[model samples]
Target chain A: MGRRNDHSRQEIREMALQVAEKIVAKEGLQGLNARKIASAIGYSVGSLYIVFENLDDLILQVNARSLDQLYTVISKTEQQCRQPDACLLALGQAYLEFAMEQPQRWRTVFEYQRTKDAEIPSWYRKKIFRLFKLVEKPLLEFMPTLEPHLCAQTARALWGGVHGICILALTGRLEIVGADSVQNLMELLITNYLAGLKNVQGTPCTPEEGTTQECKA
Target chain B: MGRRNDHSRQEIREMALQVAEKIVAKEGLQGLNARKIASAIGYSVGSLYIVFENLDDLILQVNARSLDQLYTVISKTEQQCRQPDACLLALGQAYLEFAMEQPQRWRTVFEYQRTKDAEIPSWYRKKIFRLFKLVEKPLLEFMPTLEPHLCAQTARALWGGVHGICILALTGRLEIVGADSVQNLMELLITNYLAGLKNVQGTPCTPEEGTTQECKA
Candidate 1:
């Protein structure tokens, strides 16, 4: 958008993010740095600071993009499957595939460190919850009588588990659990957890007690 | 074990591990290194190499010790709980407690990168499997008719998910899912997943079909 010889502020921001993503992809989080990104994008480190508050700020922006990309992948998965149960399975599978394809981008989203009090930005948090809705959507469709809060909690628990499987699978530690395929392990979780939810569906949980273990009561 | 003037090879190795653990605890995995360990333990960096092969080997040793501590914590929890379901909850709680207490050590186990060709040593891996067995025992106890293979797969799926929740919880990202307590999410997963298993127990899964998504069939 700037003159042919010069990148505008917005152009510099995009260039910096692209370079940062490449550094993370090639070297993992430990290898990412302000100098490398600035050098890659043909800018001074001071220019990077002008665009990003700090390295942490840059990582956050990159993570926001990754989460959006993840949501797109899961949304497409959700659209293709007609049955709710199949949709959940397909979502988990899509999640694994996304992690496999973009392992570094996926890793840094969760692994980056924040200063002790640095709060996650609200808009970024929204992208994550939006993805959760992908899981919650199929979940609610499968069990219409389920309460909204429990549906949210269940989405977190199930997706959290699916997330754990992906971590191990990506790190080559899935073998520690003696499982071969991330898909089988994921399917086992979705199918079994769903069957379990149905068994407990007869007992409705009140809002006050929904967060407790006795919700099963 | 060594004379007052000098440490034995084994003593130096232990001292290096302790120093490494301390560095990791205070500054995380990035701060850990042979020079730091050598300085803290009062040995030259060359002495560290003489005692251990490399920093990777040192991390594996430290991780082995962390896994052992994890096993000890979980084993004590397993011993106190009288019922299978209770044991699972207590184990999940114990895991959270351990991670909360030793955040860096627990994190480095899964987060460390070995060289692409580096294989996890068998003995180090055994400690991981040993922890898995603690989960498997209660799973088998909860359902006697469940086949060994399915039980193992279920344990991995369940524990892997729990691990995921723990990672999010420690990193302060657990709030992203709108869940307040890791314990509640962990319980929801275990209880719901077990109840689901109970629903499907009548449908025996032969080993041939166990790993497939069609296991539900």
Candidate 2:
């Protein structure tokens, strides 16, 4: 009976996470609740707490799994690219793709405030930092001349840039600007950001100023 | 009596928004509710719906107000910057500053998605487009040779990049990278993105490989 209960506990945890994702995806974060989750699984409210300490714990677990999936995408994309620069761009693309494909999960991760409090859970921070380190590798290769501090600063800016595009695109805010494809928008951003890095060393180089060529995909 | 009811309705709406903002700032988006809002303002629950049809309407109004305030900051910053490029960078700084200055309002605007609708509110769309046109002016000035479509694309990318940085910085995600100031991060992103725009018509650019010179602020 104890073994059976243990198996059931894992099942319950998985079940709760699946339901949470559905609610978050379909109904936004506002729809999440213990009772709603319980009804979805046809279990009593108390049963959920037995496996998960509280709603916060369950959410942390759900996000942990979701972030792990994000890590996989980043790693796979990074590993697949042969050239270092291409690898960096691919990494940015993958980051944006994840958000576009999975808007619900992406929004939840951004919306939740993961603080230092014990009640907030540490897995959230762990998953997030791991994702950052993923991009940092490609960034280091992409800009070998940058100091450690500047590299960090530049990486944060890159991440911010990619994230900004992804969120706006995911939320349909890009419609205000008349974008045909999210990919094209991001390509421009990454390309422009990379070109700017060339100017960072105080050189009078013009990526676009000297060339009369037109920008195409 | 009708006039008195109208006055009370407006006052109640204002009071509810204050409470909602306070709760969101203190506890995150999940803490928002009609019950808590009513309690915070020393009113009955029904009093809230008298002004707002439901919680969604209340949140919509709150976010609308938040957006107006954000646009005001952007306009004020633009007035001070004489150069188009400087004004664009200043706009980016203003965005980050708004996030830091009013963390709760920022979160509400980004984090709160409508439950039943994937489409953004019409008024919200209009406000966002107005903001986009602001970026267009500097972009056209900086890239005199680009066609209208490409220039619009560049503005969208810049907007996304700036928004992404603001979301990350406000949530303390940038702290992990040891990035000291949001302004530095914005400057780095804006400068890089602009370089790409200037030359994106040329051969595709790689960020780290380009000739970036540090400019004196």
Candidate 3:
């Protein structure tokens, strides 16, 4: 009886998440209410509380699940390519493809407000590092001499550019630029970013070095 | 009495937009509704309808005004920079800055949905073009050899990348990739995109381009 009850509890939480996703996808986060979700699942409001502490907790669970899914998509893409730059490009493409495919889920992951401030939680931060490590670790092999900080910064720039393209395409604002083929543009962007990495790696340490030396002197 | 009534009509419309902005900023777009807006302005719901056909129409009007304000920001940024590429970079930076500074208004632009999808009216299209022409016209000066269609596609690609970054960064997803300074990343992206324009302008068609002729032969 205990095992069966635990399984049922898990089932109810999954169902609640599905219904919440449906509500957010259709009516957006604003339309999401516990009563509405319970009604959607044909359960009483009290049943929802059994699974989730409150509405905010439910949203955080959904948001975390969505991020995990997004991370999985990027990881799968990275594994398909062996070359450092190719792997990085694949990760960027996958990130773009995921955002375009799941616009509502993508929005939910970003738009949901959590209690955590500027610093993300440790587990979430690990997932983030895992995603970057896929690109950054391979990149170290190709550009063996790059400083860790610069490598991370370049990875971030490329990632930001890809993330930005996905949002623009999904939101329909890309029309302002008169483009249709997101895939081609993304490829070109990744190519350019990779090329720029060579330059950034070779960037003179004069400015950074000067500041530090002046401070010390 | 007729002239006074007309003046009051304009005053009410402006007042409604102000209240709507306040509601959205403080509580998110979900907080905006007729009753709350009317209560905030000390007006009856009927008075709101005098200037707005419905709540959707009111939101649309407010959106139009917001987009106009957004365009004005772009224009000011462009005017401050003389070089075509610099102008594009400045405009993009200003855009990201605006979204970060006023995240609520930025989200309202992306997240708020129109109630109906009729033909896009002329005024709306014009508003869209105003932002585009800032980049399209000046970009043409720099890439004079490229055809119009190609130019539009390239411009859209650049615009899409920048806009996507702003949305993702504002929503906390960019933290996943460890993006530190959005402004510096945007500068690097714009510089790289401008550099790549040379190949698009000067390079002769490669074998892939002449495939139709080769296949016929």
Weakest 10 consecutive residues of candidate 2 chain B by summed lDDT: B208-217
- lDDT by residue (tens digit), candidate 3, B73-131: 87887557676767777788788877877788777876666665644456876776677
Error of 2 at B98 (Å): 2.6
Question: Would you give me the overall lDDT of model 2?
Answer: 0.73
What is the DockQ score of candidate 3, to 2 decimals?
Answer: 0.29
lDDT of 3 by residue, A153-202 (tens): 65666566777777767766565335666776676666545544454444
Best by lDDT: 1
Docking class of 1: medium
The 10-residue segment with the lowest total lDDT in model 3 chain A: A208-217
Q: What's the DockQ for every one of the candidates?
A: 0.56, 0.34, 0.29
Candidates' C-alpha lDDT: 0.82, 0.73, 0.69
Candidate 2: Cα lDDT at A59: 73
Model 1 segments more than 4 A misplaced: A1-5, A203-217, B1-5, B204-217
Candidates sorted on lDDT, descending: 1, 2, 3
After superposition, candidate 3 runs with Cα above 4 Å error: A1-61, A78-90, A116-119, A135-146, A175-177, A195-217, B1-11, B38-44, B173-177, B199-217
What is the docking quality class of candidate 3?
A: acceptable
